[model samples]
Target: MTGRHILVVDDEPDIRSLVQEILQDEGYSVATAEGGEAARKARRVRRPDLILLDIWMEDVDGITLLREWSENGGLPCPVVMISGHGTVETAVEATRLGAYDFIEKPISLAKLLLTVERAFESERLQRENVDLREHAQPIIEPQGKSPVMAQLREQAQKLAQHNSWVLISGEAGAGKGTFSRYIHDQSTRREGPFVEIAVGSMSAENSAAELFGAEDGETVNYGRLEQANGGTLCIGDIADMDLQTQARLLSVFQTHSFTRLGGSEDVEVDLRVIATTQRNLEDEVAAGRFRDDLFYHLNVVPLHIPPLRDHADDVHELLDYYIDNMVTHERLSYRHFTVAAQNRLRNYGWPGNIRELKNLVQRLLILGSGEEIEVAEVEQAISTQSVSGEPTAQIVPYDLPLREAREKFEHDYLLHQLMEVGGSVGKLAKRVGMERTHLYRKLRALGIDHKKGIE
Candidate 1:
């Protein structure tokens, strides 16, 4: 894991030097600025994980600088205020302006270190809480009692001990993200952020800025690379990343450093990367769509997650898990799957894998009112879905907010319909009950390829 970067901004040269040395000794990357102008320049060069700003500065006072940062770009990171003679009003104002903590100078090294640690911890907790609320799903650790799942989990745990970039290959909805998160949670840097980015979902023009960050004068946007500095960065559908972004990522893997977009100074990052792809990356490289050099870099440790059909014995457990999860998280009524229903699902080929199973369970609970889900109900549902041209199993995140849930459903419905109709936009529009032009507009709005279907 990478050490946290700390910036010490003080008017007194001696104080700046002392703080820098102290933080560096404590396993933090330290940068120092003698005044506000220098501090602004330093921040423009690279975003710090934490900033220690002295209340009194030469050119610009710390309070003014703090307000500027908070107003302009929003404080990129936590800021701690330092003053020789701190007043109650100053402390209150600093706190109100989003200072993590206010410390009186003639500072104790122990107190300073403790405060910095607390600030980072608090930030991590806040981020986690927000993620939890947004997801609203239970944090399950890939539940299954089957030998295949057990072996996979064991292998992942062992691999997590090493600090190597990992490439996870699996079918779409095969739980690649779940396995990636499992590795991160079990790894040494579990406390650090687990940042994930879906490369294919981003446009080529914006991928660079999103991954490498962008700096425009006083405004700065920290990217996934910087956000995952001390932890794991999980890149989903990495094979779809544009060549330019792939080159930049490859450079970062080689040098462990990269400059942000529109920024001159290099920002160093230490992070374990876990990339996933549903497509054959080797084929992508062979076709000149993906960079071979980048493939070689990311393929240091490759792990494949088998489709649900390959692990039939785990189907029962997965069904039970999702049933319970939906009842608890989605506030759906409890319903037990019948023995025959379980047997049928176990024998069936689950093309969509775990994600498909999860969605199936949620759909059953939402649409079925009986206390028990019977084999007939399961068969009817499967048959209906198949006739509708949807996958045998499809994932719909019902736990998402209402607007997001509707969008998800619409995106999936249209994609599945388009695929079923062999990518004919006119047929799809008629099937979905939308005008052809409106369907085109909707496809474009949803970032789907009208003729090619979802990409």
Candidate 2:
């Protein structure tokens, strides 16, 4: 509230003047309006951070104006109702009408300032939702129209509507997590929790504990299975689960029930399991490294997400999506990619997939030191850091939008960063000023590997 501007709307000049003097002395910028019409005018003119609206007015009452604003949704600022005759019932009615808070007449200056501060804080939190939406909107796009992709999405949607177990197989960076989320979003239990466990990242014993609550008289923390009781659970790289853990998991799946590691009580749940693997589970089964029964159970609704190379037609669409996102997130004056750059993007073997492309777009938006991403920039970013000593792909013009071309440049640039940093997400996130969770989400969305780079 230090620098916030406050609007005091009152028919009485004396009350408005008192509020203005008090708030101004407390370091808030205060503006006064004589009546409802004047208040509305001031709101539009000043765009005050908070409003104190008097209930009784000549032309219109505060409650009426509040109702109008609530119904039409124009004024962005929060409104606090004020009235000398305001009763608890009137205040409750005002609140039900969408007034942020009600301050009765003969208000204490201390209480007034405190309420105003809270109103400003609430408004700020509401604005953050817009930011989250901007970040989440891209990954929320339906799987595109490629025949293979459409089939994948169709299967996911159909399976999501049921409570069947699903298994997703793909090469690294093939958007397994994205598909998993899509299934969860489409499922009958969409409102239920969708817990994900990274079997490869966590220790086998600890991972078991995480998946099936703790043992031994210890208060059982809810495991992924318990958390996803009515919904879905995604197991990333399930092929990496140890034999013992796999055996226990298989039991849970078989009985549709599990007990805490140390507890004997059986907890039955209705869980829809979704497992993902970069490695071929069939090969793992042949090698005896994975449980064949477990694999079979998870494979009930088997889905193979095709790699980026298989969906070359979607390259431009993906590029545009990433670029649009990058330009907005980085607050950059977006520039188009040169013709040569577009050619290079379309031809490049995107081993990292969509996640890789997303990171690249973000990198170029924030790091590319050029008006437009040129072929030379792509070459310098990719070829100079050749992990396999291979020359960069020759530019191939499959005809893409300037924005799409820029996205290609970005993907190349992102790969370059991963190469430079040896694929450390923490370091990458730090460099980009984003949380590791957010960076990981973007990488997963773009189909980029957090482990391997261009190599």
**For residues 183-222, what per-residue lDDT tens digits would candidate 2 score against the true structure?**
8888777655567788987986598888886544212255
Give the per-residue lDDT digits (tens) of candidate 1, residues 1-455.
Answer: 35788889998888888889989888899889888889988886666889999998779988888888888757889999999987888888888788999878798889999999999999988888866654445355877777888998998999899998999999887789999999999999898888989997799999999999988876678899988988999999998898989999999989999998888888878898999999899999999999999899778789999888898998898888877776776567899999999999999887667766776776677567879999999987677554222454356677889988787778877876665444568768767889998888888877778644555
Clashes of each: 0, 11
- lDDT value, residue 204 of candidate 2: 64
Best by TM-score: 1
Range of the 10 consecutive residues with the lowest summed lDDT in candidate 1: 384-393
Q: How far is candidate 2 from the true structure (C-alpha RMSD, Å)?
A: 18.0
| Clashes, model 2 | 11
Sequence-dependent TM-score of model 2: 0.57
TM-score against truth, every candidate: 0.82, 0.57
Instruction: Write down the worst ten-residue block by lDDT for model 2.
Output: 385-394
